[model samples]
Target: MMSEEKSALTQTERTFGRRQIQAGHALMMLISRAIPHPIGEVWAAVTDPDRLEQYVGRPEGDLRRGGTYELPDGTRGDILRCDPPRMLTLSVQRPGGHSAELELHLTAEDSRTRIDLKYASVRKGFVLIDAASGEWAAGPGWEFFLDSLSDFLNGENPEEPLGIIGWRTFEGEQLGLYQARNAEWEKVKADWDHEHEATPGPS
Candidate 1:
């Protein structure tokens, strides 16, 4: 299933990137979501290494300016910048050494806090269309993350994965492409339903 999803996403990405085949630019935007936790609590959740692992990806070692972190699979990267309870910029060591800056801005409203995450992917040249389409394709991941983070911060787990599935198969015929995408969506939705059933309910 994973292989199939990956293949579909690759094809969709190729179609999405055809225009930017030469030089694809980076993506930048601010995404905001409300967390049930208080501002101070949310602040700690992002700054504290132990707390961060529960919501975001796990941390490798101490989290501070100039510190390094690794993904669960041991993909390592450095903490380019760290601002207490607020902003964080990391240099991800990927195939092309892509740099990503994650900033968490906290603001208090009523009894809850609004966390604004600005994700900036730094690449060369112009890639707005590709970036926008990729974002639309990857919407499920962000949606899952927001939902899971809300549960985690409120002292619970949704018991679900945070990711997306994009399907695409083009046969040089527009109608064929549409039908293929529709079929793929059905398969993806069914798979997601199965995964959700296997997962335990919220606490």
Candidate 2:
């Protein structure tokens, strides 16, 4: 699991073992994080379109069950479930792929909140994302947004990213973060994912 920091964890308890998936079983991702914010604040940060746009993307939808949502980068989904300041589920479809079932769970404390995110798909190959960031290739994407949420809670609204791929791409281009991130990704996949390539998983 990714802790408070956006950086990766060396070892994470996983639900899927290292193995190649054919056409039957889907790859899955599960992660949990604790944020130092109230449940209401945390919920708004993730579900509120405007606030969500501050990190993920601009969303246009009623945000109710069965409502459709399209993120800024063309990623689309249906709101499968929405529970105030607590839980949410989405049928997310990436830019050029089939839909995946996504779930989010939250619990609140007096001054903090915990979130568990899950994503699963049988039709989509999570290779790219997995190659990009091992666990988050299909994740709640806290690494990309946790800091943004922190910024929002602190009232320092950011002007870039929020859900715009171009903005993040520009930053990676400008700061060379992509090269570093990809380099590390390559190493991680080689050390970890490579073993699963030829080993067929449950079909």
Candidate 3:
């Protein structure tokens, strides 16, 4: 059962929802993970700028509902909703007129906390299939962040805090972990695709 337990530790769920937008079909990606920490602690780690700097990049600006924030990487966004230690929603404005909505929901699971992240965006001139299949970058990227968050919570320092972009910077055991996680994600994606293909779509 050791293998099963290991799989449980890295378990993640991804779903895509389609909706019509002015440009075309909009896709929403939802990813969830369970962290072995209290809800309050997880909330602080995700929302507080100081703690966020440990795993995610440090963001600057008024971090509250109706305020604006800018990441170190030059990405800017507005804080659409902030429910404090529970939910946060943002409208991310990227370059080239690209925009996206991100939502984070935290639920308490006994002594652990469950984090649900939703990312929705509309491709200006792309079809649903085009946007859906290229999810390798987004999916594995978020998984890395969540994994880094878990490491930080457990008092472990991550060698690469920037996730997939800095893949080549990691070495030895850290590099091995990143490669292993990528392989795991590939298996998860394959299984998800197979099951969905056999199932019926919404009527």
Candidate 4:
């Protein structure tokens, strides 16, 4: 499964070199960026609920593994893994909604910090049409939040939470490429699925 699922995608298909790949029926979204700040400083800004509320959303919890947190929109999660200033994992879900996995990893790079963000749907089966839709969701959404986080790190105004509409325009411009990629991804996914003799998972 692992061997055949390696993404045959180019950097051009990625956002800031972020790779989106098919894992069974799952789509693993990966985004990474280097921020100009110490790892601890970067970690603190991200982990602190108050600091986060300034940019993204409200979160309240002890923030340790086994801890539970409430998001501003009432989405909640339990910390599945937590290694402060290094890595954190959570099983997230909304009220009466399907669950998802969110993970954050931090590393030091000279005087700056590198962060990788991943969001994976737990049970929802994924395909290219959905992935194109996801690009419109996770890509611009994270870009907006990261931009806000950057501003907060520099003691600047943490901008408002930008929505998915901006990427709607992006989707319009990339419609042709997205459609082609969707078709290619669908074929690759179908081939991989048949090769593995696996049942399709739930969406």
Q: List ranges where model 4 is wrong by over 4 Å.
A: 1-25, 123-136, 159-203
lDDT on C-alpha atoms for all candidate structures: 0.49, 0.60, 0.70, 0.61
Provide the lDDT at 102 for model 3: 76
Q: Any runs in candidate 3 off by more than 4 Å, and if so which?
A: 1-10, 19-25, 95-97, 124-136, 163-165, 168-203
TM-score, structure 3 vs. true:
0.72
**lDDT for each residue of candidate 3 in 1-203, tens digit (9 for 90 to 100):** 55733574358876655544334566666778888899999888888888877777788998888899987766688998889788998887755466777788999999999999877778532212133443324555566678788888899865544622454555786556555655565565566557667666799
Task: For residue 133, give model 3's deviation from the true position in Å.
Answer: 15
User: Clash number for model 2?
Assistant: 6
Q: Candidate 4: lDDT over CA atoms? A: 0.61
Q: What is candidate 4's lDDT per residue for 1-203, written digit by digit as tens? A: 33311221232133211222232234555557778899998988878877877766768876678889987666788888889889988876755575667778899998898888776664444333454444334443443456577878998853453321333444453444445445554555566556667677999
Quote each prediction's TM-score.
0.53, 0.66, 0.72, 0.62
**Considering TM-score, where higher is better, how would the candidates rank from best to worst?**
3, 2, 4, 1
Instruction: Give the per-residue lDDT of model 2 (tens digit) for 1-203.
Output: 55422243322222333212222356655556677888888888788777776666778876777789887777787887887878898877776666567777889866988776666677544523444433334332433455467678778876666565432344433224333434444455465556666777799
Per-candidate total of colliding backbone pairs: 0, 6, 0, 0
lDDT of 1: 0.49
RMSD of each: 15.9, 6.2, 5.4, 9.0
Tell me the spans in candidate 1 whose CA falls farther than 4 Å from its real position.
1-25, 94-97, 123-140, 158-203
Cα displacement (Å) at residue 92, model 4: 1.6
Least well predicted 10-residue stretch by lDDT in candidate 3: 124-133
